[model samples]
Target: MTTATPAPTPAPAAAAETGVPAARRVPVARAYRFELVKLVAQWRIRLLVLACWIVPALFVIGVEQQSTLPSDTLFGRWMHATGWAGPLVVLGFAGTWALPLLTSVVAGDVFAAEDRLGTWRHLLVAVRSPRRIFAAKALAGLTVILLLVAGLACSGAAGGLVAVGGRPLVGLDGHVLAPGDAAGKVALAWVCVLAPTLALAAIGLLGSVTLGRSPTGLLLPALVALAMQLAQLLPLPVAVRLALPGYAFTAWNGLFTSPEQYGPLLIGVAVGLAWAVTATALAYLLFLRRDFTNPAHDGPGRRAVVLGVLPLAGLLAVTAAVLSPATGATGSGIEQAKVERSVATAFAHLYRMQTRQLNRPDVSEARLRATAACDKGSIRVPVRGPGNDWHCVVSWHLPGTDATGTAVYQLDITSDGRFVADGDGPKEVNGYFLVRTPTGDAPNPLWQFDGDVELLSHSKG
Candidate 1:
C-alpha cells in the first residue's frame, strides 16, 4: 500500500478537479463591503435614501405656500424671515420623530434580517468570526444613518435657499445675522444632530441583536425617543435632562444666540458617545455568545447577560463621574445675574428693531444702554432660579432722549434657562403683538420675547 500510495492527491488539487472552490476566510474589510452591498441592494433602503433627499425639499416648498407658519416649533416663526429658518424648522421636527424612526428602520433590521432568513449560520461559516461580522454590520448601519442625515440637511437647505432666497437671519438672541454667517451656523447645527442619531442607531442595533426580530428592533429606538421626550416634559433637574438622549435635538438653540453657548452641545456629544459605546459593546458580546445551532433560542444566556449588564452599569458610573464636575451647580440653579443679562441684551436688540419699524432713526445696541432688574415674586424672595412669578423692570436710554424708557416684563422661566418675557406696556410701544412693517405685518419683537441665559458662563453680571 505504501508503494502504491499516489501521494494522496493534494486537497487543493482534489477540490479544484471536483469543481468545488475551497472555503476561504473573509477579511473584515471584505465582510464590511459585503454588508454594504447587501444593504444597498434592498429596495426599501434605496427608497429610504431617495426619500431622505427629496422629502425635505417638498416640505420647504409646501411651507413657502402656506400662510400660517409652524410657530410652535423653534425657528418656525422666522421661516419667512430668512431662508435658513426653513431647514432649522425642519430639523426641529425631524429630531422628535423622523430621525429615530428612520435610523431604526435600517439599524434595527440589519442583524435581525439575517436571523429571520435563517442565514446567520451561513454568514458565520463564511466570516468565521462573529466579531468581524458584527463590526461590519454595525459599521454599515452607521454609514447609512450618516448618509440619510446628510441628505436631509443638504436637501432642506437647498430647498429653502431656492424657494425663499438667502436673507439675514434673526437669531434667538434677537440679534440679526448676515446671510453668510447664518448659513454656516445652520450647517453646524445640522452636524450637531449626528451624535444623538448615532446613539439611537446603536440602541436599535442592540434591540435587533437581542430580540432577533426586525419589527421589535425598528420600534425600540422610536419608543425610547418618545419616552425621553415625555421625560423632558417633566420637572426633572437640568443636569438630568442634559444627559438624556433627546436633549441634543434642542441643544442647537444655543448656537443661534449672541456669544454662542457650547456647553449643552458638548455635553450632548459626550452623553451620546457613552450611550453608543455601551450599547454597541453589549450587542457585540451578545452576538458573539449566541448559539446559532438552536434556531428556537433567541435570548442570551445568563452568563452573557451578566457580562453585558456589568459593562453597562460600569459605563454609566463612569459617564456620571465625568459629567458631574462640568455641570456642577450651573444646571442645579439658574442665577439671577445670568437671566438679567440675557433679558437686557435681547431687549436692546428688539428695541432697535421696533424703532426701525416706526420710521425712527435706527438705535444702536450700544447706544440703547439697556439694563434689567428682575425679582421672583416679592422682593423678600430671592430673584434667582426658574419660575413664572419672575418680574423684570427694564430701563433703556434712547440716544437723544433725556428721560429713560422703562418697560415692565412678566417672565416665565424654565429650568433649562429659557424664558418668555411678556411686556406690560402702553399699546403704542411694547404692548402690540404685531407691528406693521413695509414688507407686511410682523411679530412685535418687544411684545413677547424669548431668551436663554448661558448656564456655563463664569462671567458675573
Candidate 2:
C-alpha cells in the first residue's frame, strides 16, 4: 500500500512559508491611474476634447464674418473693439448651457457605463474596495472636466486674439482695461466658473449612482440646470434668486465692473460647495448599498428616492435660511437712489465719447457734474423697482459754458439691475442711432447705453 503523499503546498502558502511575499492588492493610486487611462481611451471623451478646442475658434470666425453684433449678450457689442471680448461673450453662452451638458458627458456616465456593460462585478473584484473605486472614478471625472474647461479657455483666447487683435477691452462700467489686465480678469472669470460647474458634475454623479441608466444619468443634470434657469426669470425674492444654482452663472458679472464687486462671487462659491458636498455624500452612501449581484436591477424604487431626497431638501432649506438674512435687505426692491447714481455716471461717460466724436474740446467726467431724476409710468411715481416705463431727466454742464444741458431718457430696467437707457436726442449733440465722426459714421454711444447697479445697498442710512 503506497502512502498518498501530501499535496504540494499551495502557491500562496508556499510563498508565505518560504518568506517570499504574496502578490499585493492593487493600490488606490493604481486604480485611479487605470481610470484615467480608460477615460483617455474612450472615443466620446476624445471627441469632446476636440470639440472644446475647435468650436470656439469656429464661432469667433463666424461672428467676424457677420455684419451685425450679438448686442443682447454681455460683451457682444464690444467684440469688434477687442479680441478679449470674444472670450467673455463665449463664456456667457457656455455658462448658461454648455457647461452642464458637457460636464455630464463624463460624470453622468462614469458609473452608469459599468452598469450598462454588466462590468460592476468585474470592477469590484479588481478594485476590492468600493470606496477606493469611487474615489478613483470621481478623480478621473474631475480631471476630464478641468481639461475640457482649460482647453475651451485657451482656445477661445487664441482664436479671439488671432481674429480681432489684442486691443484694450471695454468694461461694463465704461472703463477701458489694457490687454494685460483683461487677460488676468478673463482667467479669473473662468476659474470662478469651476465651482458651479463642479457642483453640476456632483449632481450628475448622484444621478449615475441612483438611476443605473446612462441616458437618464446624462440628461438629469442638464434638465435640472435648465429648470433653475427658467425659475430665475420669475419675479422671485432676491434671497430666493441668490440661492438658486443658476445664479452662479451670472456671478462673473461683478468681475467686469469698475470697482469689482465680490458679494455675488462669494455667494456663488458658498452655494456651490454646499450643493457639491451634500450630493457627493448622498451618492457615496447609495453606491455603498447598491445591489451589484443583480445586473438587471433598475436603480432605487419610489420609496428610496423619497428617502434620499428628504435629507437633501432639508439641507437646502437650512442653507436658504442662513443666506436669507444677508440677501433679505436687498430683497425689498431696487432702490431709486442706486438707479440715479448709475444713470448719472453712465451718461457722463457716454457724453464724453460723443464730445470726442464731434472733435470738440475734451470735457472731464467729474466736471460734467451729471445728475438724474427718474419717475415711473404716467402717474409719475418715484422709481423704486424694475420697470420698462421708467423715464429720467439728466442734466450736465457742457464744455466751457455755464449753461446746463438736459436730456430725457426712457429706461427699460430688469430685476437684476441692468438697464438700457434710450436718449431723447437733440440730434445735434446725442445724434441718432449713428453719429458722423471725422473718420466715418459710427454707433452713437449717447443714443443708447447700457448700465448696471448694485442690488444690495451699502448706505449707512
Candidate 3:
C-alpha cells in the first residue's frame, strides 16, 4: 500500500518535469541585510567604535581638570579654548593620532576586506547582478562613514562642553551665541569638517577594488591625502582651490559666525562627489568583469591599473602646473619681530588720541606695561592698560591677513569687575595685556580667554 501511494504522488508530471524548485527571489531588504552581516564581521569596524568613545572621554577629562585657567568673561575663556591655537593644542593631537586615521580605517577596508577573505566571489554568486552588490557595498560603506562622522563629532562636542564649561559660545564675529545656538553651530561645524573626507572615501574605493587588500586601500589613500594636503599650501591657480579635499572645511568655519556663507563649501561638495562617482564606477567595472580563478596568479585587471593611475596622474599634473613659491616671506612676514612693539606703540597712540579727546593726562610710559600682545601678518603690537584699576583698555591690529592665530590685542583702561592677569596684578596694571584674539582682516572685541587676560569691561580688576 505504501509503495502504491508513493507512485501516485509522482504522477504529477508537470512538477516533475522541471526537477527543481523555482528560484527564490531575494528582496532588496534581504540583500541589504546580507551586506550588513558581512560588514559586522570586520575587526577594524569594532576597533573604530571603541576608539571613538575612549579617546574623546579622556580628552574631556583632561581639559576639565585643568579648569584653573581663569576666565575674565566666561565666554572669553571658552573662546580661548576654541580659538585656533587653543583647540589646536587640544583636538590637534587627538585628530592627528586617530580621528583622521579612522576615516580611512572604516572606508578603506569595507570593500577591500571582501577580497581579502575571498568572500567577494561568494557575494557575487548570491547576488548575481554586479550593480546590486556594488550598491549594497556603497550603502554599507556610507552608513559606516556616517556613523564614524557622527560618533567623532558628538564625542568632540561632549568633550568640549565638559572642558569649556557649558555656557554661551562666542563667535569669531564677537557676537555671543546662546548655548542652544552654540551647540548647533559646533555640531554643524563638525559635520562640515567631515564632508571633505568623502573624496578620501573615493580614493579608498579605487584602492579597494584594484588592490583587494585593506593595507593598500588604507595606506595609499593616506599617502595621497598627505600629498594633496601639502599641495593645497602651494601657490596654485584660483580654480585649483575647488579641488582640495579640505577646501570645504574653511567654509564651515563661516557657519560659526554671523552671515552664513556656503558657496565655497557647496563647490567643494560638488567636486568631491564628481571624483567619488568616477572612481566608484571604475572600481565596479573591474571587480565584476575580472577573473578570480587563482589566488596567487589572479591579479587586478589592466583596466584597474589605468583607472587608478589616471587619477593619480591628474592630481600630480595639477600640482605641477599650479605650484608657485615665493623667494622669501612677504614684507609683513619678515617684520614679525616688531609685533610686540607695534601693539604697544599702536595702543599708546590710540590711548593718546582718546585721552586727548577725553582730556585725560598723557599716561606715563612707566605706567605702561605690555598687557596683551598680537600681530597681523605684518606688524606685532602690544596692548597696554591699567591692570589693577581696570582703566581704559586699548589695542590695535597691524596690517595683513592671518588665517589663524591672534589678530588683535586690547588694553582695558578701567577694570569694572572681571579679567585675570597671571603673576603680579601690578604687572598687568598700566601694562599691555591680551584682551582678544584677532580673526580674519577685521578687529572684533571678542576672543577666547586664556588664564591670563581679561576683556569684560564691566568687571573691575
Candidate 4:
C-alpha cells in the first residue's frame, strides 16, 4: 500500500507570518514613500506644480496692466497700490474656486485613476492591504496639496514683490504696515489657506475612492467647495456658517487688520480638520468593504447613484429647503434711536480715523459733534426693523470752518447688526484721501470705506 504522505502544508502567506490572519498590516511608512515616488514621477503632476509656480507671475503682470481695479473683491480695491495687494487679490479669487480646483487636480485623480487604468488588483497584489493602500494614497494626496499651496504662496509673493514693489501695505483698519511686516503677514495668510485647501483635497480623495470615476472625482469636490461658498451668502444660521469651509477661507481677512483676530482663524482650522477627518474616515471604510478582485463585478452606475447623484440631489434639496420663502411677512424693524446713535457715533469715529490718515491729527471726533435723526419710508411705519425707505439726516461740523451740512443717507440694515447706507455726504461719500496736514488738499485713494458699514452696538441708545 503506497500511502502518500500528506504534502507539507504550504508555507503561510506573508500576511499570516505574524500568527494573526487579519492583523498583518504592511508598513504604512513604506507605502506612503512609494506613493510619493509614484506621484512625483507623473508628468502631469510636474506640469501642475509648474503651473502653480508660473501662473501667479502672469496674473500679477496682467492685473498690473489693467486700468480698472476689481473693487468687488476684497484687497482688489487696493491692488494697484502695493505689491502685497496683488497677493490678497489672488487669495480672494482662489477662495472662490481656483484653489480647490488646483489642489483637486492630483487628489481627485490619485485613486480614481487606479480604477480607471484597471490597476486596483495590481496595487493590491503589490501593496497587499487595502487599508494601507488607502492610507498611502491619502497621505500622497495631502502632500500634493501642501506642495501646490506652498508653490502658489511662494510664487505669488515673488510675483507681487517683483511687479508691484515692496511698499508698505495699508491695513483694512486704516493702519499702515511696514513692507517687511506686511510680507510676513501675507505669507502667514497664505499658510492659513492651507487648512481649507487640505480639506478640499481630502474631499477629492473621498470621491475618488468611493465613486472611482475621474470626472466625478474631480467635479464632486469642486462642487462641494462652490456650494460652501454659495451657502455663506444664503440666509443660513450663524452656527452653520461658522462650521463651513468657506467661512474659513475668509479667516485670513482678519490677519490684514490690526489686533489680528485669531479666533476665526482657529475655528477655520478646526472646521477644515473636521472635514478632512470625516471624509477620509468615510472613504477608508467604504474602500475596506469594497471588492477589488473583479473589475467585471464593479458597478460604476450603482456607485455613481449611491455616491454621486444621491449626494448631489440631497445638497440641492437642502438648498431648496433652506431658501424656501416663509408664509409670514418679514421685515427688519430697526429702532430709530439706535440707528441715529449708532450712525452718528460711527460717522464721528470713521471721520476722525480718516482725518488721522490724512495727517490731520487736529481733526478730533469731539470737534465734529456728529448727530443724526433717522426716519423710515414716506409714511411713518413703526420705527423698527430694516426697510429700504429708511433714511437718516446726519449733521456734522467740518473743522477750521463753521461748515455744517445735513447729509441725507438712505439706510438698509440687516438682521445681523450690519448696515449699508448711501449718503450725499462730503465729496459724494468718495472715501477719505490723505492730504498735506495744514493744506488738507489732494484726492489720493489712500483709505476709503464707501460700501457697507456694520453697527458698533446692538442695543438701543
Candidate 5:
C-alpha cells in the first residue's frame, strides 16, 4: 500500500507556470523552428546549396567565355538569348542536371534521415501526430527548394552581368529581345520552371514517407526528371507533356521571346502538382497504415517507382507536343505556306552553286524584263522553280547606294554563291541590278523584311 502511493504523485508535463494554460499546446511555431534547425544543420542541404550556386556559376562562365556574341552556333542559338552568364547557365544546366539532383538529394532523404537516426520514435513522440510531422518536413523541403532556386537564379544573373555585356537576348525561336524585356521574361520563365519542380520537393516527401527515411526516396524525382525530358523529345500528342511534371523543364526557353509560350509550362505544373498532391497524400496514408517497427527500404525497390513512372508516362505525350516543331508556328501562313512549297525551288540552284556572291549595291530599280508596267511602276522578277515560283520585287534605288540603303538581303550564303534565307520571311536577293556597281564587294550578313520576317536557315532547306 505504501509503494502503491504512486511515487509521490508525480506532476504532469505541463506549463512551467501553472496559470499559463498548459503552455497552449507547444505553439506549432516551436515545431517549425525545430524543423528549420534540423534542415539547416543538414550537411546534405549545405552541399546542395553549394552545387546550386557554384556549379551553375561555373557553367555560366564556361559557355559565355567560350561562345562568340551573336554566335549562330547551335548552343548559342539555343541559349544566347539569355546570354552565357549564370542565369543562362543555370537555365541551361540546372534544369538539365543540377536542380534535379539537388532536389533528389534532399527530398529523397527528408524522411529517410529520420529513420536512419532512429528518430522516428523521437519525432513522433514530440510531434504527436504523423500528419503534422509530415507537414513540417514538407514545408522545410519547399523552403529549401525555393532558396536553391533563388540562389541559382541570382548566381546566374550575376555571372552573366559581370562577364558578358548586357546585350539584347535572342530567343529560342530566333527572335531578338530587348534587355529589360529579356530580364523580365527570363524571371517569369524561372517561375514557371520552378512551379512544376516544387512537386519534386513534394516527391521527396512522399519518398520519405514510403522509405521511412530520406536517402531511400531519392530515385523517384530523378527518374521523373529524366523521363520528362525524354517525353518532350517524343513525337506524340500534346496530352503527354501536359500531364507530366517534368514538362516545365523545356518550356522555360519559350519565355525568352514575345507571345510567351507556356503551354508546356502550365501542363508541367498541373501534372507535377497532381503527382505531388496524390503521391504525398498516399505517402502519408501509407504511413498511417504502415508499421514502421522495423523501418527498412529495400535500397532500390519497385514500390516508389510508380510514383515516378505514372506521371512521367502521362506527361511524355504533353511534352512531345509542346516541343514538336510547329510547322504553322514557324512556316505556315497562306503566303508562307505557298512560299514553303516553292521558296526552296527558286533558291535551289543558287544554294547548290555554293557561291558567295558579293552584296549588290542597287536600290530603286528603274528597269524591268520587258514585262515592266509604266502606270504600275513595277519590276517583279519571276523566279520560277520546279512547280513553284516566287516574285522577287525589284523596286530600284541608286546602284552604289543599294547595299547601304534600307534594302535587306535576307540570305545566308557560303563563300561560294550558295545561299538560303536563314527560313520563312523576306530575304533580299541582290541580283544584277538596273544600275549595278562593279565595285560592290562587302560581304554583309544583314537582312530585313517587310511585314513579318521569315528566314530559311541553311539547315532547313
Candidate 6:
C-alpha cells in the first residue's frame, strides 16, 4: 500500500510546479481558443454565415437583371447602372434590423447557453474565474459581429462588380467619383456601421448574462433596436434626435455625398461605444458577483436593472422634454433668401446635368438661367417658418426656342441644408427617352420624364 502512489499526471504536476495559482494556470489565451472553437461549431452561427453570403449574392444577381431601379433608397436609383450602388442598397436594408438580428443570434447565446445546459458549475471548475469566461464570451460575440459584416460587405461588393461592372459611382451631390474612390468610400461606410453593430453585440451579451436564457436574451436586444428606430422618426429636439442610435445608423450615408461629412460618423461611433461599454460593464460586474453553485437562484440583479434603467430613463426624460410643444419647432431657422437662392441655383445646375444626360440639342447652361421666388406654404403664411409645405415659382429660358415659361415647384426643406424640389418643367422631366452614348443609342428610360419634373437637394454649402 505504501509502495504505490502512482505519480500524478505529468501535465498536472508540471502545471503545479510552475507556482501559478490554478485560476492563473489556465491562460486567457486558452480560454479564447476554447470560446472561438465553440463558436465556429455552432449550427446557428454557421447558418447565419451562409445566409450572409447567399442573400447578398442573390440580391446582386436579381438587381442586375431587373429593369427598374429601386429609387426610394439613397443610391437605389443607380443600382442597375453602377456596381457601387449595391452596397448602399444593402446598407439601407441592413440598418433597418438585419444587422442587429444577425449579430444577436450568436451573441445572445454565448453566455446564456452555459446556464441553459446546467454547465455553470462545470465551467467554473474548468476555469480560474468567471471573469475569464465572461471576457472570452464577449470577445467571441464581437468577433462574430465583425466577421458577419466583413463577409456580407465583401459578398455584396463582389456580386456587384461581377454583375454591373465597376462604373463610376454617382454621388448624392450629383457629382461622379472614380470607381476606386467609390469602392473605398463604400467599404468605409460598411465599416462605419460596425460601431452600432458592436453595441448590439453588447446588448445581446447583457441580456444573456442577465436572463440566463438565449431566447430571452435575443428578443430583448432586437426590441431595443426597434425602439431606437422608432425614436428617430419622432419630432424630438435636434439634440435628442442627434443622440439616438438610429441616427448613427444613417451617419455613414454622408460618405457618399459631396464634401463627405465626418460629424455624424464621429457622433455615431462615440454613442455606439458608450452604449457598448455601459452594457458590458454591467454584465461583467454582475457576473463577478453572481452565485455559480445554484444557477436557478441566479437572476439579473436589481443593481443591473438600476444601472441599465437609469441611463435609458434619463434619455427618455430628455426626449420627452424636447418633444413637448413648449420647446417650439425642433428645427433650425429656414433662411428664406438662402433657400430661394440655393434652390434656384441647384435647379439650373441639375437641369443642365439632366439635359446633358439626355444629349438633348439646343440646351445651353447659359440659356437655363432660373429666377425663383419661394413662399413657405400658402400666401397667407408669409413665407416664414418650416412645416414641410414650401412652394417656389421659377421662370426659365430654353435654347433654340422662344420658350419662356414658369414652372411651379413644391419644396420640402429640412433644418439641415437639405431640400427636395419636385416640379413640372417645360418638357418631360425624366421619362421615356432614347439614350445616345459613345456606346451607341439605346432606348433606356433611365432618365426621362414629363413636364420636366425634378428632385433636387443641396446638402452642402
Of candidates 3 and 1, the better by lDDT: 1
Instruction: Report the candidate with higher lDDT, 5 versus 6.
Output: 6
Ranking by lDDT: 1, 2, 6, 4, 5, 3
Best by TM-score: 2
What tens digits encode model 2's per-residue C-alpha lDDT throughout 237-326? 667666765566777777777788678778877787777787888888888888888989767756447645676667667766777786
In candidate 5, how many Å is residue 381 off?
33
Alpha-carbon TM-score of each model against the true structure: 0.88, 0.90, 0.62, 0.74, 0.63, 0.79
What ranges in model 6 sit over 4 Å off? 1-23, 312-349, 360-376, 379-423, 430-461
Q: Candidate 4: which stretches are off by over 4 Å? A: 1-26, 258-261, 297-425, 428-443, 446-461
Angstrom error of the Cα, residue 206, model 3: value is 1.4
In terms of lDDT, model 5 sits at 0.51
Candidate models: Cα lDDT each? 0.81, 0.79, 0.49, 0.67, 0.51, 0.68
Q: How would you encode candidate 3's per-residue C-alpha lDDT over 23-126 as one tens digit per residue?
A: 44455667777776666667768777766656665655565567353344233245334422223223333333344466577667766766667776676668
The lDDT leader among the candidates is 1
Q: Write the per-residue lDDT of candidate 6 for residues 198-286, one digit (tens) a residue.
A: 77778788888877764767676678788887766454444455556555677776675555657656666776776777778877877
Please list all clashing residue pairs in model 1, or write none if there are none. none
- Over all chains combined, what TM-score does candidate 3 have? 0.62
* lDDT of each residue in 59-121, candidate 1, tens digit only: 987897798877656777777767898899889888998899887788988988987788988
Provide the lowest-lDDT 10-residue window in model 1.
Answer: 1-10
**Model 4 vs. true fold: TM:** 0.74
lDDT of 6 at 260: 67
